[model samples]
Target: MSEAVLPMSATPVATSRAPTDWNGEAMRRRIALRYAAERRFRLLGLCAVLISAGFLAFLLISMGANGARGFMSTQIKLPVDFPRSPIMIDPAMLSTNPDQVLANANLPQVIESSAQAAFGKDGDDYISSGAVAALRKAIIADPGILTRKVTITVPASAGIDLAAKSDGSEADEAAVVKLEQARALSTGFNGGFLTSSDGTDPTVVGIWGALKGSLLTMAITLALSFPIGVFAALYLEEYAPRNRWTDIIEVSINNLAAVPSIIFGLLGLAIFLNMMHLPRSAPLVGGMTLALMTMPVIVIAGRNAIKAVPPSIRDAALGIGASPIQVVFHHVLPLALPGILTGTIIGMARALGETAPLLMIGMRAFVASPPGGITDPATVLPVQIFLWSDEVGKGFIEKTSAAIIVLLIFLLTMNSIAIYLRNKFEKKW
Candidate 1:
């Protein structure tokens, strides 16, 4: 068996004429060349895909690198605790006069006293002199601080905060030295950035109030835009005839979507704020402006979504003796809900981030107090970021960037929802 070596039953002779054309050997070589070419094509496509992915990754990394730093903020934990012997803020001492308020007690002195009482001797160095101003602002904001000792969490000063979070490696020797003193002061967040209202001071400005305003604006957008848009879409797709007027309306809608957002802002101010004299910076006004801007988009999207639904569905509903309205509402609308919602969410989110119109209405101005309702003066996230980014402070840079990140996160989440709905509910008839 080891010695056995077998060949074909009939041994073939070697050919000198390059083997006959289209012989097995030649065919095999051609097939191999085709495979090699295909492999090259596939490899090129893969390289292009990888390059595209890399660019996308770079973009996201840039956003996260800048935005993630915002989350690492300066926070100040107060030594304040519940006091057994509370210095009753006699209601009589609640006066608006700065001198009378600071009369016998400077804001620093009062807060210092509170701190000593709370953390004892250990709390003396724990507080900063600037912390006194924060306390003053708090007291002025709420005169009731005279009644009870409360623990508050505030943001630390920018320099102090940056030092705590940074490893000192990123900063130059000079900047690092500048931050040394801030680091030496009792370590912790120097607060005001979290709970306070908008201000030029990066160390003092807060996002808490703006968060509420955006929520209200979105609420108004969803409440008003969805129903109106859907109805308009249904009418156009199902009931409206293809007439000259309808053609004009459709053209106008396309034009509206193309109109500059700022133009809408200007129109909003003219109609809602100046003419109607509604609250200037109210979420209601903002929502209305955005809704008007979004209506055409919704109508267009809604019409498309509705049109995409098979007419068979409508015919089937009508065959059962359903009225036109009933058939549409019950059968057609249900089928198009996913697309409708996707458009609505997209429009609402876009409206939420819009700032030019909000600025036209006066949301750029500072309000020491938060809004009480949708009609109250409000500032949204985009406008808030714009305000902060203009401030001439290193700290505000991170803060502005952080706000932008928050906005991006929100946008990404909304898009994800829309895509999810689209893919999940997509139908192939």
Candidate 2:
């Protein structure tokens, strides 16, 4: 009875509402704000990319402008009356024992005399110190040339080279002018920069030795780190039980990845050089040292890649009578390979550019010749660049920049190869 007597204000009432106004001012404002935020974010990203690109362009342009000359040689042609010159070597001796013949012939004196005869008393000063070696090489190449009058084109001295390319001292400028007037001074591609090895004279110094050493060292590093890192990742992710020991190992690996690169250098120095007695500046030791530093990064990347593989994939493989090992190797590994290669590229690139670790391991030595093998004394490109940058000679400055260009090219080549491999292995499913 009391419920029936309830007032209208006390009674429950049903209400109806209009459809949502998607085009309403509030909704439009919210949508506009989102679009504006997205636009702002895109603008920020574009600006970031442009700034990075600008820096990279500046680096390339500056290096090219400075180091282009490094890849060029200034040559001065000089007439040598070999028959009248004081070269005492028998033409026959050049073929049988050229080194001995050239050494005994006193090529420096021969070159100096030839230069002075062609130009004047200061002609010798305009010739590169490397002229002796150049002349010796020419003699060995053609023993008959030793018996006749010939014009030899040899590299100009460093000062004259600078004067021809950019700037030089007053004497060098005068020499350049005179040589130019004689049509003896000409700038040409420096094939020797790629073919020869390190030396005191910048005209003859080359990057081949350091480049070869870097390749050999990287070979060792890739050989050691890739397989080891992959297997380690597999074990840690798939097989290792959840235990205190596994946790500790996981933490240690993470920490190792963050350790200062110099720490790895010290470790290599102590173990490879002091205790194990490996060759101090050998690519073998350097490669092994770099392997230690690169492995952790590879392992971390590999683990994440492996973990990303769908569990259903493993279950399906197991359901089809595939063993666990087969599932991991045949299926999981293939799926993870692309990611693994990405990590490998990053690791290798970092190793390639590293100087502190190599320096600690004695790779800073002045390697005058390319190493015959990994165990032989060698220096990597970064160490070579570091050494060249420290030189007082103006020629070495361009050389340093040239070395940097080479290093960048090498890195790009390596990364390109790795990326190609990764793309080849990547799967859609």
lDDT of each: 0.71, 0.91
**Backbone clashes, each candidate:** 10, 0
For residue 279, what is the lDDT in candidate 2? 88
| Clash count in backbone of candidate 1 | 10
- In Å, residue 28's CA in model 2 sits off its true spot by 6.1
Off by over 4 Å in 2: 1-35, 427-429
Q: Write the per-residue lDDT of candidate 1 for residues 1-429, one digit (tens) a residue.
A: 332354542665454556366668878999999999999999999999999999989877876876667656545555443243332333456665654554444455555665566445534334444565665556667766555666555444565556555642333233334334334223443234456667655655667667678778877877788789899889888899999998998898889988989999999899998899998889899888888878877888898889888988888989999999998877888789787877777777778788898898888778656678998888888988888887776777778777777677767776787677666765631
lDDT of 2 by residue, 282-301 (tens): 99999999999899999999
| Stretch of 10 with least lDDT, candidate 1 | 167-176
Candidate 1, position 324, lDDT: 96
